[model samples]
Target chain A: MPAAIETRNLTKQWGDLKAVDKLDLVVNEGECYAFLGRNGSGKSTTARMLLDFIRPTGGSSELLGGSGSDPDIRARVGYLPGDLNLPRTMTGRDAFNYFGGLRPSGESDVRDSLVERFGLDPTRPVRELSTGNRRKVGLILAFMNNPELLILDEPTSGLDPVLQEEFRDLLAERKADGATIWLTSHVMAEVARVADRVGLINEGKLVKELTFEELRHQATTEITFGFAEPVPPSAFEDVTSVAAVTQDGVDLVLSLNGPVGAVLKRAAELDAIRVETEQNDLDTIFIQLLSGEEQS
Target chain B: MSATLSVYRRWIRDRRLSTVSWTLGIVVIIVATAAFYPSLGSTTASIADGSDSGEAMSSLLGLSSGIDPSTPLGYLWISLYANIVPWTLMALGVALGTAAIASDEDTGALEYLLSGPVTRTQVAFARFAAAVSVLLLVSFLSGLSMVLSLPFFDLTESVTTTAPDGSSTTAPGATVGDIATGTFSSFAVALGLTGIAFLIGAATGRKGITLGGASAVGIGGYVLYTLSSMTSSLDFLTWLSPWRWYVDDVMLINGLTWDVTLPFITATLCLLIGWQAFLHRDLQSS
Candidate 1:
């Protein structure tokens, strides 16, 4: 079977600035792929290209094994843009009826369930809704059709913590039902909860691609080893999984990835007097990765 | 329903309030103008009966060769139906056309709409149809109000004509059909002007440009025609203005002419060009 979403050398340029550049990406069927990037890192641009909202300056993209511009193919895909704006006078119910009427197969029960899940008031006009409520409306519309693929950008942006949790649960449920979700987010916690694989984009280029397992085993530990005799930080340089080492007096701090077996053996060889290890969370590691503070 | 039809229905529903208000507003203007017919009828009749004064007044009021301001058709044309009614409709038309694509795009609502199963082509055509439909509805209501008030204004009496060739004749007064045809002319002219706005909106997706451009064209056309009516040197430029074709024949008194078809043709051409431009250009998302 073909990938749910695929791009080959996909590039978009506005004059000299490349919004998205030679991005070769694939989201396999039933996979939850998190596109991690900072603001203006081409995440929304890529999503727009996939939806055919803007044409790629070079190369192409496909959604559900068909051209993104094809209406029939778009029908099977649900999209939540970075910014959601609805007609001001339209009530939530009005939007549901109007957009639902356009669907090839109308499913009112599903729409209702989503509304209920999100605690959305169907009678309120869009203009009267708060930012979070507007996001709820956007989410409900995106999930109403039970689409095969969901492309969401900053999906949980305005939601409270409680609603964010609910959104994660809803995403998990959709993933369990074999839906392919491609979401772009700068929030590390949210991505950690739902992402099976993550591709980090920086300045319109894919910098790193890591699976959940790889992320779990990423360079996240900072080890502090002290010795009676002063030792250089390079003493542990040859050790596997050691990302970076910093020396202070007779003490050295090492950022490690794998088990501490090799580091311990080396420590014993160096007759280390004291040793301490602190496990770092994914966010810290992600920051270090982005800041180029961690050694390759 | 298809996405195109659904969009059309939603658009109509959204504009329902504005439609009612514009239609009612035009009605009020018609009623207020018609109330003057009772008092102004005799004064206008004397003017029509006096050849020299009538010639100067006809030219000033944009009246045709055979039209006499004393008659119901002539009074309505010079006083309300010709300039006031069409200009009011023109305001509504420019507004509707500007909002059709450009305003929605400016608000970012259009991006959300297109994200659905609807295509850009569907949106372009559906929005144009919806705007045009509202123009027609408002125009029809305006015409109906004029027709209904004819009896109250005592304008159903037959008219007497004085020819420059030393002859006189009598013709039936303005009928409901004449009022309907007159309103149709206004609708057509407004539609043509609105079509220009719609085309600009579709091509540029800028509300300000659409409104300003269409208004400039409408007002500019009228100015050109008026100036051309006085100066023969600028008369050729009147062809560029639908106002020329509109008031030249005085459809309410002279009945429908081939000139009435000009607005429809212009509107169709503008719509086609707008649609093609919209399809090719990138949507200006906010």
Candidate 2:
């Protein structure tokens, strides 16, 4: 596949501080790559480097297979900075007109529709708007051009839940239209819903990359089987479906991975009385990965 | 429209209120000062006649040889053009130049703007041009105010001063051309300061450093020239100050001279150097 965004050992260093360590990333055309990282973990720095806002101390990056420093290449890119700042006096409508005219694409009804979808007032100046509204303007600016690639930093930051869902739907539509997305977001659910691949960055390094399925597989839940009599921890010891087993009086608490079918069968054979399952979401998995990385 | 033009227009629009306010403030000062010309013109000239304090005052007024302070051109030069006009314009220039990149970059707006389909070079030049445009507008309006009010304030009448040694000297009435020369020279000086401010801002991308550096050059130049004029000991240091030639040339009363072109050269060089630095350096995070 043609690469929409590619970086080879990209590094940005300020003396002893490395804002973006040697990172090698490649998001193929039509792929939604979720760049997940904790705060100050080089996510925004990497995005800025990708867009050529900051010069890398080493290596290089290419956008749409062309240099980010090239204006023509950037014209095909829609970027939403984490902290979007326009002139305070500029109205939302003015921003659309000004930024929209820069691209080869015309100012289409898509912009107006996006405005309505985000529930933003086009007439009010940016200073008068709330944080969520400001974020809406940033979103509209990023999505308005229908660019080939969207590089968004904290795309849903400061957004209400409904607007965030609306933004996600917009992202889905754009993705269906063959647009490649490279975004950094703390919302794990949002990432799980849309991303094909997720890259975990920490301490200026790209720590791990995995597909959504693989990430979901790492998401483990706790299942406890209650019984009329005491069950030894060894009851489910040999079961691969149960990652960890512990005895709590007459109950068996199992760290469950994948399906609970095998455990259910084992519990039935053992004449288990009740089965209660506690589900784990992606947020736990992400936190575990980051904390694990920090410990190491 | 081209992105450069669009960016330029947007910058201009953003500063429209500020530019208008600066122009109006300057025009008011010019008219207000001119209003006093009819009342205090001769008295000021008589006070400057051969006293030690008078020579110091002449130096302060930027008076040239044989130019009586009582004459219309001399009076306007001493009262407004020499100090107030150029210094204020220079201050404005410094502010505009800093605003061109440093202020916006400081607020992070410049970074957002650069995220568009515009090159750093385009934005740099667009902003600098906008800053210069505003400075020129203010300078032009100031000169126009002085010229239009010249007749109402009796500054259009030629003055003859008789020397104590029985000799008489006649100085020409202030002309519109003289007003143009004075305004353009003041604008030029301010342009040089503007360039310095732009260069500092571009190279450093910090507002405090840019403002401080440019202001130091301006205020330091004045102090250097003033001290140099007072004593021969500081005369060698005078060459370092742009005011040396500016005050010595007294373009308003002495008419146009080679000194008027130096600031233009300074401005172009600063712009070129600053633009190159801006293109090469990383933007400071807001």
- Residue A104, candidate 2: how far off, in angstroms? 2.2
Regions of model 2 farther than 4 Å from truth: A224-240, A245-253, A258-275, B50-58, B64-67, B165-167
What C-alpha lDDT does candidate 1 achieve relative to the native structure? 0.86
Mark the regions of model 1 whose C-alpha exceeds 4 Å error after superposition: A222-280, A293-296, B42-60, B64-67, B159-172
Query: Where does candidate 2 chain B have its weakest 10-residue lDDT segment?
Result: B47-56
Predicted complex 2: DockQ: 0.72
lDDT per residue as tens, model 1, B56-109 = 345546565555677777788888866899999999999999988999888888
DockQ of each: 0.60, 0.72
The numbered model that scores best in TM-score is 2
Per residue, candidate 2 scores C-alpha lDDT tens digits across A1-296 of 99999999999998999988999999999999999998998999998888888999999999999998888988999999898888878999988998898777856798998898888899999868889999999999998988899999999889888888888888998999999999998768877778999999998999989999999888888998899999888988888788889889999999987678888899999999998988787888999888998899
Model 2 alpha-carbon miss at residue B61, Å? 3.3
Best by lDDT: 2
**Model number with the top DockQ:** 2
Global fold similarity of model 1 (TM-score):
0.88
